[model samples]
Target: MANRLKRTSEGFISYRFAAIVIAALFFASLAGWIAQELVPPDFVERKAFYGESWRPGLARAVDLLRLHDPFHSLWYRFVLAFFFAVLVACNVSRFRRIALRSLRAELPAGAEELRKRPLSFDLSWRSLAAGPRGDADPLVRYGELHGRREAVDPAALEGFFARVSALLKRRGLRVVSDRADGVIRFTASSGRLRSPGTMLLHAGIVVITIGGLIGSLFGWRGMVYLKAGETAPLPPDSAAVLRVDEFRIVTGHGGAIRSYVSTVTILGTRGETLAAGSIEVNRPLGYKGVNIHQSSYTMGEGEFARASVSYRLRGETGRRTVELRGTASAVLGDGAAVVTALRFLPDFRMGPEGAFSASPFPANPALEVEVSAAGGAQRGWLFLRHPDFNARFAAGIDLALDGVEPVYYTGLELSSNPGAPVLMAGFAAATIGLIFMYFCNPRVIRGIATREGLIAAGVESRWKASFELEFAGIREAIRREFDESG
Candidate 1:
């Protein structure tokens, strides 16, 4: 029963289980992107684009699944949570094994165990005395005496163990030795932090997952539009106010829009400035944990529009121009008549009820004006594209909308995530862990040193081919030392 339970526990935390959970999370995220980003929100728009055949059923399914906000949906969150749990379990299980292996020193009990190692060699006084025959090839020389055991000189055995320890120490390994049952054992290692570095990488991933959960649960995002000097309250229960100080559309050489820039200020509830800066495309302003980005811009409406009106006395060829901003009034032609600009509309249209703007784009600009004279007051709409429509409004005055320049309002997207700093810290930790794990080489060498012979084995965490050559060098050096001692 205990063995069954252990097997079940191991299977639950295995890499296969973790990979399955990761795949589920990936599909969930993909579904979220398709629903929220690719699909239109309006049912009519969706029907128009995707065809009306499958619209109703698809829309109903999307709504039922809450696919419009999948990241925040219960099912998506559940999947993510499950993945996180699996990752934590796997990391914990692996970490225990790695820690035990890396922190403690263990040696083979006897010659049989040492011989089973991939890079193992046995040397005796007789083998060292024989040495290499011709070119002194380390690989060939070690291969010749790998498993042979012969009687050894006690003094020579002591000298050989001491010399091997010194050589490993010079190569930056921490060496430890033990003596038991008429045999001396030695273990040496380098890059002890490599295992811990791997664990740090796993820990960083766990931290990043936690940070993402925090952000997904508590963060908020919204958009606000503000003209110059206009202020709007920040969204999602924030007491701060976001004010647009200025907005400009930077144009390139051919009069194409290069970028949209907005100079803005963040004010506290008490109207004190909390932060202030300029934000353009790809540049965002950060205040506390909130980020404000310049998203878009549109032609301003109402009081933000400036209009130029040209007027003349009836049947007169000469005309006079008066500048009018919003509903401000200006006298025309020797102050005989007053013209008040009541409203301005971009993309103007007349509906069943009255005049209105179809859209914010300046496709068909129009200006509403009220002309007052000694006879009476007449109100009329002057179309900038068609001056003839304004002819019959007043008896003795001619009015025309000569030109209209639009002021632009900046569109800004604001988002706040309390876990952003934590996420950044996780990324930094993961980067350091990667550098340590990849750039540093960790290796271990173990051997049984006895009066009869020596059996040594070495292994590297990576680059097995290179470490094999290094191990051969160590064997050759030991052979040379014994030869000199002789």
Candidate 2:
């Protein structure tokens, strides 16, 4: 039973299993994003978009697989959990290997073992004395005496090993030497933290996965539509109310819309305002851990639309402002004339029979009004953009359309995620780990120095070409040191 358990655990933590889990996560996330885009948020709209051909089959598939909201689905969460487990197991296994390699202090068994390494060389004193011969490098191989064991004086061997150890120490490598059976074995290493740095990177990935799971399980996302001067209850079980005080559309040159802003207020249960602020694209308003983002807007006639009209009587020196909504009447100049708003047209147009609106968008807004006085009544249009046209209807009173209240519903997306900070911390940790792993090149050099000459080998974690040059430089330095001493 213990052996079976061991086999299962080993398989679960294997690199092949980790790769399969990673692939599953990537494809799952991709499919989720595609489904989110193809399916509408509203159920009716999603059904309509699916059309008649996909009525039962595709619809059932989408619902059964939870494609519309895959991130929150049970199967996706299970996959994420599996992926996290794989990462944790793999990190543990890797850390064990790194610890073993870091703690081990044994040198290569013999010259043959050293020669099998990626970088290795054998040198003898006879060839060094002969000097460079026919392009044969003494630092790499001792010319014709390469790999040949030759006698060396004990005192000379001791001096040579001492100089090499000092050189390794000067180059920031930790050196350890052992003497057994007249053979001097030494090992030197630098940048021992490289493996731990790689382990840190994997641990950071595991942390990121944990954070994502927390967000998926506990977080909430919803949307709400609120018109100007309107209030609605917040979604996802919040008792707070979200109110839109005003909405403004900023236009740039050529009358193109630059941005839209919503002045919003969050009200407590007692109708007390908790927070008030403006929200624009990419900017969100936060209240009680809920973030409200301005997602979109729709234009149409609003139930509470109001028109601001300014009027002056024939004998009055100043004008008075009055608000009108949907055929509401207001007195002008102490009841000298009763002004009634008959119709309002946003993006006005003069039809053959009457005045009408070209579009719901407020461009060239105009208001039609009826003025009643002792001399009878007159009806005319007051243009908000072109106030000069008001003079045509100045029979008893001069009137101008100052402005009109916006009739737009601001769409706000509300979300709350407690794991965002954790995710950010994970990313920062991963970045630091990557920097350490790439820049801190770990290297190890082992050598056996004896009366029969020297055998050396080296290995580096990465950047083999650069390490080769560095190793060659070290060999040359050793050779130079010996020649100078002689």
- Predicted model with the maximum lDDT: 1
Task: Give the range of the ten consecutive residues with the poorest summed lDDT in model 1.
Answer: 43-52
The Cα local distance difference test for each model comes to 0.80, 0.79
Cα lDDT tens digits, model 2, 182-254, are 8898888887777767877888887787788678788898887777888988766658889999888899999
Q: Can you tell me which runs of candidate 2 are displaced by over 4 Å?
A: 1-5, 32-51, 54-56, 70-75, 100-106, 133-158, 166-182, 221-337, 340-402, 405-416, 484-486
In model 1, the runs with Cα more than 4 Å from the true position are 1-4, 27-52, 55-73, 134-158, 165-176, 179-184, 234-242, 248-295, 302-322, 329-405, 463-486
Model 2 residue 341 CA deviation (Å) reads 5.5
Model 1, span 128-171: residue lDDT tens: 66565422756545655464346566676777788878988987
Candidate 1 has a TM-score of 0.72
RMSD of each: 5.7, 6.3
Q: Which clashing pairs does model 2 show?
A: none
Clashes of each: 0, 0
Best by TM-score: 1
